[model samples]
Target: MSHHTAAKLSRSIISRLGTRGFSVNISETTQTFARLRPAFAIRNLSTSVSPNGSPKDEKNNSISSDKSQNDKIIPSYWGVAPAKLTKEDGSAWKWNCFRPWETYTADVSIHVTKHHKPENFRDKFAYWTVQALKYPTHLFFQRRHMCHAMLLETVAAVPGMVGGMLLHCKSLRRFEHSGGWIKALLEEAENERMHLMTFIDLAKPAWYERALVFAVQGVFFNAYFLAYLASPKLAHRIVGYLEEEAVISYSEFLKDLDNGSFENVPAPAIAIDYWRLPPDSTLRDVVVVIRADETHHRDLNHYASDIQCQGHELKDAPAPIGYH
Candidate 1:
């Protein structure tokens, strides 16, 4: 109820009580009534003014008003807010991380079983490095899909951001366009981070696992940054192999869901919205889409490495913008 309407009702109640011959304490009755007020209604109330021309409560009311103003973020300019979005069925779009327009149906039929054989020293080094990294993760998580995916994504998200930042700097230095490589790399990073978000909703990791992610991300980010700076070709090749591993991991995840090892739980709301899956989609559906995503990442990174290896800059070929 509005403050003015509430005040009128409060006075009516007190008048009725007085007429009914009840010896009532006005202050106590008002206090009791105030206690019964809805929380939102009680909020931002001007302090009680005892009828003695006192300024005593004014200070408290001003303080509370100041705090309320400080806590609430009001839009400052005409362009501050974006238009609200609705889903296909006209329900409000609930996600802030992604928009409905950005969402798409996963191409589940895409052939995912492709591999790149190491033909050169750089390729061999990248392949071996990825192999070395994978063994430790396998030993640690040991078949815990959710924990493993969460950990994997923390490392997986590093490459694209690092690569994008470097290319962005190069573009700035040369005063030229990146030919969409920057956006492509950054989008890949966002997608990888979203993978982590989805996994986390399904499983809460142990404290030690969370601690490990903190340490691992700090170290891996710097290491990958240096690796990309030294050789973009090698860095992209490494990520290509890493994505191949992700595809394998996700395929196994799908199998576990099917074979009754992992529960085929309903997909997280975030996953459903981001991937534009049906409301009835299950974890199995989530895995299929995720695996398909990994396939794209694998091929995209390998394609990126190939472009550089062929002595052509990434700008020479069109980057797959919004390819996912």
Candidate 2:
């Protein structure tokens, strides 16, 4: 017979012998018939296939070879580790309290002197409460610009935390989302806190000032929490008026710096990084950015109050985020 016929006859004899419990290795040319037979098998213990269609063990070799050396040094637990950060010049980043992504150039073009007239009883009560709180701080700080800013930020940070906490608990209780209000309010709190941090770097608080902060924070936190629980509208309105006072205070701080009443100190490193200011920025630049941030906070709280006054839950409307 011809070579082709002879090969076919050999394959037929191997198939019969394989059925009779004889082991036979089939060549690629007979793979089609081998597939029809149940004897041809390659057990794959790995999870991946190579580009050339071979199994690759995930614990040993990758199916697709990665070219970059960067992939090799990453620890398996890198997902849970702190980020390796860099600055604009690729130097190592400092400040674990915040990240580069959170830094922003403040929009100093915001209208700072605008007022929300207290047309209703709720508004009136809110406005007067702020006035009552403002005079004491003004009297205490007097010309101490740095001290005043520290105290103002400490107090300003409280309302957002209160509101955010209450909203968070409510969301959990009802199994509902907060329409971004929780995150917005929490961000507002953190922004206010960063203001405090910047001011602390500018001037260290005296023992009395530290004591004052302790007392004021305790009282204000409890008061705001209760107010939020009772009436979110009034609570937010009160915070809105308070932020108006904050803007006015920062404006005064700016004026003092400009007039040489308060020395034009170099901007704190924290302030420079947080506000994305120039290398030559001074106390005046920091105050401008902070004042602008207060304007935004003022608007946010006022907007929240307006929504509630219009007979809607905070969740009924979308929050205006990215204020800072």
Candidate 3:
């Protein structure tokens, strides 16, 4: 081939490779062309190396640097896939964490509240039940929101587990699916349990508080079970209101932290791992994320109530899995 034709063929091949996400370094291509004919290659091929570096080289380095940074930022544990297991009878079994569809953020703020009238029997019942529990919590705990949170999480975890269990049984009995509500509720229960675990590391509850947790869990579990049986709509509405109070309480906790009323201790290891928080995260960071979780629960329970009010089962719609 003539020297001119050879140069044209090489340019065409390079363009085709570039279209397929491939690139040839200009210097390398020039060297290859030099082997064909020194004078022609030197005349046709030219490359500029700037003071910093070649622009193409810098761009490639920057892309690789970005990929490495992202890999470091996102931990492997964030959304791990499950491994399959074999049952005793050789049947396949698998279980995994509920991964959220969207990234978790502590910056988003959502506050929702519901007012229950004294004349409305069901609303009144739920209102008093939540108030009866909240008044003592505030009066006793006062500024000790960490301990209060530990206690509250213990109770909060109960409703989801109970709701999930009931729904599972109902699904089996009625031969109908619950639109994944059981799995969603179970995931919520687990998430709340992790919150309790995280707080336990921060605040050691007093013996009385431990007893309080036990007594409260016992009574509340049975009461909530009966309440859910009687009316799932009322149960969900009550949880929604309870979560609103949680957001308020956490907001107060944040205020206290900012005012230096509460020491800004390093966040627990569990909190850091679960929330993918920065290495230097403090108790205030933990509270911010926990408050976000409560907000999510508040919205979800209210949505559930709305579905029930529309004369439809939770099975009629998809549950917000891994919302927290």
Number of backbone-clashing residue pairs for each candidate, in the order shown: 0, 0, 0
Which pairs clash inside model 3? none
The candidate that wins on TM-score is 1
RMSD to the true structure for each prediction, in A, is 15.0, 13.2, 19.6
lDDT leader: 2
For residues 44-100, what per-residue lDDT tens digits would candidate 3 score against the true structure?
Answer: 644323344322231223111233223232212122223334434564322223222
Residue pairs in collision within model 1:
none
RMSD of 2: 13.2
Sliding window of 10 residues with minimal summed lDDT for model 2: 72-81
lDDT of 2 at 33: 72
List the global CA lDDT of all models.
0.84, 0.84, 0.76
- The digit string of per-residue lDDT tens for model 1 on 156-224 reads 989989999999999999998988999999988988888888988899999999999999899989989
TM-score of 2: 0.75
For each candidate, give its TM-score against the true structure.
0.76, 0.75, 0.66
Model 3 TM-score, 2 decimals: 0.66
